[model samples]
Target: MTVIDNTHQRLLPAPAADVGRLLDRIGRPGDPLWPSPTWQPMRLDRPLSVGATGGHGPVRYHVSDYRPGRLVEFTFDPRIGLTGTHTFEVIDHGDDACVLRHRLVATPSAHMRPLWPALIGPCHDTVLEHLLDNAEHAVTGTVTDPVRYPWQARLDVRLFSVQVNATSVPQNALLLEAALPPAAGPRSDLADAYAARVPPGVTTDPQAWADAIFGNPPPAVTALFRLRNALVTPFGIERGDRSAFDTISRTDRELLLGTDAGHLDFRASILVEPDDDGVTVTLSTHAVAHHRTGRLYLALVRLFHPPVVRAMLRRAAAAAVRPRPVTPPGLPTTTPLR
Candidate 1:
């Protein structure tokens, strides 16, 4: 067994109590401050308390201790090669300042020790820095120098040929894959949520859904897309057509949307199917580059594609599960009798 220990700390211009509040809110799923694009918003099954279990994705732990406004500690449950304690501690630095420290002490089995230095360590360091930066921003109302994913951290992202093929193949390919909670109702609920946000005439058909959301994009996404195109325009890449979603494709369980920009042809599809656990939503894209410049543009798109799709799907899932308000009886309906 090899012991692996790491610590990271940040000084914030805020009271200890304030810093503690910010720390307590860490590890939420979909939190913007979490640096890692894949694992986000670590969620606990219950409120913070001793004996409660929580962690993100596959990393599960039991809360061993907690002191309000000061400390929280979690003990790992023998995962792979890791077993030990992780802690967050807050120290007071007078009334106007405080320091927050995160410590991890683990014993890694022989096979895992080598992985620690080469892969885990670098990624952990990047995440810690971002966490501290978020803490400072929450408490101080400013982030001096925001941490960005270094090349090493980006390289740490796990990539599998299977995942790529699963998402990028098939006509009107589904590029993003996700599973929603069984209680979220059904795929149609998610489709409705997405459909509600798209422009008029965009339907839930898989192909059209994909085109409206990806090819044409909404205003918010279009802005970002335009900016990216502007940066690469000098290199011969053309801007996307904002009117692409005006066309429609309808199918039983699949929808396809396609567009041509410069020397590349873009096709996207959405397929929703029910499964034993819940519904599976797939958003996929297939691009054909006719020349070198189009290939270059496609490469950049592929780099950012997964994270963007994940984010969009996550948001959709959240929206799908959100409880809707029920109007009480006797209230006037928004419709009049004919």
Candidate 2:
């Protein structure tokens, strides 16, 4: 038998079950190590597909052991360059929190382990940050930025944790789409393509842009649009800016680079509304689902969800309309010296 091991720990302000769900998100569904979208209702014993999205190379996963509120272990193809089994565990602290741990028994091929220090090292840190932030958000109402953590570790196993804010869902389609990666295209080409779909004048003003994207959304929607675009076009106010942008609300709209880790579908919507507050705009931030034209047509529901887009529009409108502090009158006009 092969032996490999490593570990990290995080103290979260959440119960074991909630912590377990947060851990599940660490390795995306259909990740090379865990191939499939569906998590088993009971312990996973046989091989299974962890997710259904396309773009994943062929791989197999087997869930070997599970203990409610405690531990889960699984094995899968590590790809040719990587090989391993993964374990996710939770240790109760006898309070409102628990310690979450992840361990991987991996052996990299000749080229991978050496290069991993530089390549995977940084991303592993990012993964940990993401886990903690996601956990805090899951447990609390505030959204914490994932860039705060600075600890780094190298191990045959990976571990991450965070205090999650409790979130509820009513089976809306938008959340699923938000979980996907973004589409890809040349910056100019993508902007041009999206611009073509954007009606004139609307892209000029942040408020108008919101109106154009959402069907007369609220002022908050306008603010959200402006914020999201601001992130994309930090310097230039061009509608064709190509920078990748992300929206992280319960419902979100994002323009992602294709080179990102996961596969994505492309979808969008534009709407306009008129009111005293200004035109409210709503935009769809959905990617086409990896599945369509299959025997399971119900799967299409999973493909094109847009609720998050709506929610983002609402928030943007609120942020857009928030009162800005007025600039005090400038000092008396200065006379020009001859």
Over all chains combined, what TM-score does candidate 2 have? 0.37
- Give the Cα-based TM-score of candidate 1 against the true structure: 0.53
> Candidate 2 regions off by >4 Å?
1-4, 21-62, 140-338
Model 1 RMSD vs true structure: 15.7
Q: Over the stretch 1-338, how does candidate 2's per-residue lDDT look in tens digits?
A: 33345554556667887776555543343222221111111122222334312212222445656665477665655554557766678888677777766676767777667665765555444444444444444565333233332334222111211011112221233433454445432211111111111111122243344333344444554565566456534423233222223222232222222112112233343333333212324343333323322213224323322333434443444333322211223322211111
Highest TM-score model number: 1
Going through the candidates in the order shown, the clash numbers are: 11, 46
Q: Candidate 2 — worst ten consecutive residues by lDDT sum?
A: 157-166
What is candidate 1's lDDT per residue for 102-221, written digit by digit as tens?
A: 899999878778887987778777767767766665555555555556656655433200021233233333232112224322321112112122111112345433443454333555
Question: How far is each candidate from the true structure, as Cα RMSD in Å?
Answer: 15.7, 20.1
| Local distance difference test, candidate 2 | 0.38
